[model samples]
Target: MLATVIHAARDIRVEEVPDPELSGSGADAIVRVVAACVCGSDLWPYRGVTPTDAPHRIGHEFVGVVESVGADVEHVKTGDFVIAPFYVCDGTCVNCRNGVSTSCVQGSWWGGSDRSGGFADGGQGERVRVPLADGTLAVVPGPVGDDEIPGLLTLSDVMGTGHHAAVSAGVGPGDSVAVVGDGAVGLCAIIAAKRLGATTIIAMSRHADRQALAREFGATHIVEERGDEGVAAVQDLTGGIGADRVLECVGTKESMDQALRSARPGGMVGFVGVPNGGPELPVRQMFNRNVGVNGGVAPVRGYIDELMDDVRSGAIRPGRVFDLELPLSQAAEAYAGMDERRATKVLLRP
Candidate 1:
């Protein structure tokens, strides 16, 4: 099978690799790659921010069809269309039971293990094996076509993460929410805020294209500022009180500070950006304002079902986040497009 292999920084290639075999002592499922996406977080590995000495397959968001199942797998069967969650969780764990499976004690991240990933030898290929199938894979209702695959694939990661961010931040009816990012996940956060009943969604974006999408996703206002000016704009939109809830979708220190400063006193900030640079928290400011900060790596597994219903009902069109599409063979191009901000999100068809 041909898979995307990252042997070093800025060194991603599509090459033939041995297919993965089921060897884990748990329910397993083999899924044929249908639609997979390039994530902003994937850029970390691509740029050598994350260590990878050996050739690593790099992908986590994907939707596919089941090709085979292990003996213990019962929830799904061969031929079933499914979306694999980015995190491999043991559903019975304490965190999983509480809908925090991303922090599950036994959670497994796709593509980071010897087990390979859905990116190259995984979902970016013809097929890939999914461990803990009963817990990690969700079967999509009805047959999915090419058009619907992009939206469905978002449930595997970005869409769910965005929803989690909005929910955690306590976005509610008539509330003003500020989303601090213009990437796919940030755009999804805007959509999530809208779905949660926020009336005034303030999207802080520097790009016109992303700002336009933010409006489409229900942002009532767009702030094309940064630093203190960005925070002031958000506060101005909220009548000088700051947003009722702020969704921090970028993990940098500046983004985090913007999120904190953009929220009203006693308000909540939900952050899900994978912190890239070392971001220091202004504890004194947070304490003085009594601001509630809550966020972490999104546990996408828990929100898949609810989000699927919204997608199926057409209440949300998360697929719009994918502005570029390429064949799996051109995965490197996909990465370049996203890194250069030429595309909001890149979808690869295997």
Candidate 2:
């Protein structure tokens, strides 16, 4: 099988790799990937912002059909369509029970070694060996059509992540909301804000295409300016008081500061962007206003079932963020398009 490997900065290649199989505990499963995509986080490594110690597999978000399951796996079986969250966790762990599955005691990630020291292939490949199979995989009732695959794939990461940001910020019915960043996750945040009944959604974006999509996804107002200008724009839309809840989807000092400043004195900021440049919280600023900040790496597994319902029912189309699609063999091109900002998100078919 062929899988994507990042050798170094700006170097991405698809090369033949070993096929995955069940592991010793019979707690693993092998999934034949139907679709996978590069994430904003993946770009950190691609752009050399995040150092690559050694060549390794890349990619995290994916959805596929179960090719096989281990002896202990019970919730799903062969041929079931499933969404694999970016992180692998034992569902019964204390952290998982508390709704923070990403912190599960036995949690691990794809494109890396499993807890047992065995290889776990990345999602951007022909197949993957899923750890904690029973706890990690969420079944998507099928027979699902090709048209629905992209939307379902979003449940693997971005859609669930966007939902986490909204939930953390305590976005409620009739509340005004602001979303920072206009990437796939940010656009999905707009969908989540609307789903949570936020009446006023302010999307901060300067790109024409993203701005159009933000409106389609439920952003009632668009603020093209950034920094102080952007914060002022959001405040003006909200009667000079700022948004009641702010969702920060970009992980940068600038974006974090913007999110914190764009909220009303009592508003909360929910952030999910993977930290690239260290972003600090000003104690005095947060104290002066009654503002609060909450959110971290999204525990997407916990939100999958609920979000999947909406995806299945066509209540939301978060997959619209995937504006580009290519074959698995063209993995290099997919990375380039995203790095160049030519595609909001790219989907790969194996």
Candidate 3:
């Protein structure tokens, strides 16, 4: 089997590796990964800012077909197409039951070694061994074709996170929202804000291409400024007040600060960017203005069912974020294209 291996910083390669050896029979399942992609979170280690002691397997978002399932795995069976949310959760745990699957007591990240189960080298590969199969894998309905792959794939992470951002920011009908950053997650956040009924969606994007996509996704205003200039621009658009809600998709201190300032004094800010060391916030500033902050890694498993219907019905098209696609063999290029900002998002097909 061919899989991605991160040998070092900026060095991602596709090479033949041993197939995943499924363990246990209670809930484990084997999936032939059909589609995978490079995520903004994956870039932390690739850039070496997150630090790595040894060669590590990368990637966590993927969708695939069930090849085999343990005896106890009944919800999904052979030939069922499923989307593997980034985390493997047992669903019965307290956190899972409460719709916070990311913190499931029996859950673990894709490549982590622990309880419920595990996947080898993560999702950017030809195959993966799913832990807690029944609870972790969401079965896609009916017969889905190639055209829907990208959309289905986003349910596993990106789109779900964007939805989380909007929900956390308290975006409601008639509310004016501002989205900071123009990355894939940021663009998806624009679509999500619209889906959630925000009357006016303002995307803070400097890139023409991304701004165009943002508008297409329902952004009513585009603020290409930065710093105080950016905040003033958003305020001007909202009638001398700031946005009612702000979604911060970039984890940098600058982006976070911008988001805090772009929101109305009592507004909320939902931040989902994987903070790679620079997400510090000034408590004094937050307290003085009453900017509410809430967000972390999204509990995608909790929102999959609702978002799936939206995708299946064509009401939302988050998959269009994948502007670049490559075969599994070109995984290195997939990483480079994303790292160089040459692609909004990169999808890999196996």
Candidate 4:
């Protein structure tokens, strides 16, 4: 099988590799790769920001058909089309039961050493093994049209993460919301805010394409400014009171600061961006304004079902974020396009 292998920083290649073997019997399954996507979070390892040994698999968000299932796997069966959550968690765990599968006590990060990811050696290939299949994989309701696959794939990660950000911020009827970052996840955050009944959705972006998509996703306002100016722009649009809720989709300190500053006093800030270097909190500013900050890596597993229905019904078109598509063999080009900010999200077909 051919897979995308990141041998070193700025070095990625499509290479023939041995397929993964399935030996686990406790809630495990093997899936035939249908489609996979390059993620902004994956860029951390691609750019050497995260230390990784050469030749590691690189993808996490994917949709596939089940090729096989372990004896204990009951939620899914062979031939089932499913979306794999980026995090593997047992739905029965204490944290999972509390609706926090992202922090499942027995869960592991998707594509980590303990559990192989779906990038190169995983979903980027013809087939991949998924551990904790019963909990990690969400079965699609029925056969999805090719046109719907992109949106269905979003249920695996980005769209779910974006929805998590909006939910965490408590976006409600007539609320004013601000979304920082214009990546796929950020654009979806705008959609999520709209779905939550936000009256004014503000997207902070400089890219014309992404800005356009933001509007399509329900952003009522677009702030092209950066840093403090961007925060002020959001405030001005909200009668100088700032947004009622803010979603931070960029992990950088600058983006985090903007999210914090863009929220009104007593407002909430929800962040889903993977913090590469830990960001500092403006404790004094937050205290002065009585602001509340919450959010972490999204618990996508918890929201997949509802999101899947929305996608299938055409209520949300988060899949439009995939402005570029390529074969698995061109994984490097996908990375380059994202790194250069030329594409919001890239989709790959095996």
Candidate 5:
């Protein structure tokens, strides 16, 4: 099998690697990847912003067919199409039951060590050994056509993360919302807000292409400014009251500030960015305005079931965020396209 390995900053390669096999707790499963993608978060490591002390397998979002399952795996069978969440967790843990599976006591990340001491291959590969298979892989009940595969793949991460941002902010019917960022997650946030019944959706973006997609995904207004001006733009769109809910999809300090300031006095801000250089909360300002903040690593596993139906129904096409698609062998080029801002997101087919 061939997989992506990041040797260093700006270094990405797809090379032959060992094939994954069933392992761990008699519960692991091997998934033959059909589609995978490059996330904006992956760029941190690719750009060397996040230190990569050693070369490792490096993707997190994928959709595939089950190749085999361990003896203990019960919910899915061989040949089933599945969406694998970025994190692996046992379903019976306290946190898993409470819908925060990311914090499960037995939780492990993709591309890292599995519970059995064998490698858990990253999504950017021909096959992956999915830990906690029953809890981590969501089965698509019926046949999945090639046309719908891209959309289904988004359920593994971006779509779920966007939905988390909306849910954290308490978006509801007739509320006004502002999304801070124009990356894949932010655009998906627009779709999520719309689905949650927000009457006004403001998308803050400086890129023309992303702004267009934001509108297509249900953003009612586009603000091309940044910093204070961006906040003012959002406020102006919402009749000077600011948005009722703000979704911060970028983890930079400036984007966070813009999101916090774009909310109304009593509005809430939901943030799901990976916290690259985000700042500590402005305690005084939040207190003075009665604003609230919530969000973190999205519990994508929990939301997968909730969002899968929408993806199947064509109610939301979050996969549109993937502007480019490449073969797995061209993983390095795919990374470069995203790094250079030439692609919003890239889907790779094995």
Candidate 6:
């Protein structure tokens, strides 16, 4: 099987690697990856901001067909078309039961694990093994086609992350909202805020193409400014009170600050950016303003099903984020395109 391996900063290659096997492993499911993508999180390692090894498998967002399943995997079966959200968790855990599956006791992140008993799990490859299949893989409805693959794949990560941001901020009907990034997640946040019944949406996008998509996704206002000017723009549009809710999709210090300041004094800010630089906060100030903040790694597993219904119904087209598509062999170019902002997001067919 062939998979993407990042050897160093700005270095990526698609090469043949040993195929993954089910081996009847504990609750494992082997999937033939039909579609995969390079996430914004992938940039951390690509830019040398996050150090990675010479031959580390990369990527996490994916949709595929189940090739085989372990004996104990009950929900997913062989030949099922499925979407694997970026994280795997044991459904029986306390956090999962409460719907925070991203923090499941037995959680493991795709692309790589963190300190909490998580490690690197591959998502961009010809095939890969998923742990805790019943909890991790959401089987899509039958008869899915190539055209819908991109949208379905978004359920695995970006779309869900955006939805989480909206949900985090408690967006509701008739509320005014602002989104703080122009990347894939930010655009999806616009779509999510619309779906959640936000009547007025302010999209803070700096790019012309992204601003267009933001409007297409239901943003009523496009604020292209940054820093204080950006906050002033939102304030001016909101009659000087700021928006009712703010979705912070970029995980940078300035972006975070912009999001915090762009909200009304009591407004909620939902942030889901995989922080690249250290993003700090004026904790005392936010507290004094009574501004609420919440959001971290999205519990994608908790949102995939609901988002899928919207996709299946043609109510939302989140997959439009993949502006560039390439074969696995062109993985390096895909990375370059995204890094240079030439692509909103890249989709790779393996």
**Tens digits of per-residue lDDT for model 3 on 126-223?**
99888888999999989998999999999999999999999888889999999998998899899899998998899999999999999999999999
For 1-350, candidate 6 gives per-residue lDDT tens digits of 89998999998988888887665455888899999999998998999988876678988889999998989889898999999988787778899999999888888877564334324358888998788889888999779988999999899999999999999999999999999998999999999999999999999987999989999889999998988899899999998989999999989888889989999999999999877667677899799888988998899888998899889888999989999999988999999999999999999998
Q: Each candidate's TM vs. the true structure?
A: 0.96, 0.99, 0.97, 0.96, 0.98, 0.96
Clashing pairs in 3: none
Against the hidden true structure, what lDDT does model 1 obtain? Answer: 0.85
lDDT of 2 by residue, 77-148 (tens): 999999999999999999999999999999999988889998889999999999989999999986998999
Question: Which scores higher on TM-score, 5 or 6?
Answer: 5
Name the better of 1 and 6 by TM-score: 6
Candidate 2 global TM-score = 0.99
Better of 1 and 4 by lDDT: 4
Candidate number with the higher TM-score (2 or 4): 2
- Better candidate by TM-score, 1 or 2: 2
- Candidate 4 to truth, TM: 0.96
Error of 4 at 230 (Å): 1.6
The candidate with the higher lDDT, 2 or 4, is 2
Sliding window of 10 residues with minimal summed lDDT for model 3? 112-121
Model 1: how far is 72 from its true place, Å?
Answer: 0.4
Worst 10 residues of 5 by lDDT: 112-121
Cα distance off (Å), candidate 3, residue 134 = 0.9
Per-residue C-alpha lDDT of model 5 across residues 72-166, encoded as one tens digit per residue:
99997999999998888887899999989989888898899866676789999999999889988999998999989888999989999999999
Q: What does candidate 1's lDDT look like per residue over 103-134, in tens digits?
A: 77766776655233332135566677787788
Give me the runs in candidate 4 sitting further than 4 Å from their true place: 113-121
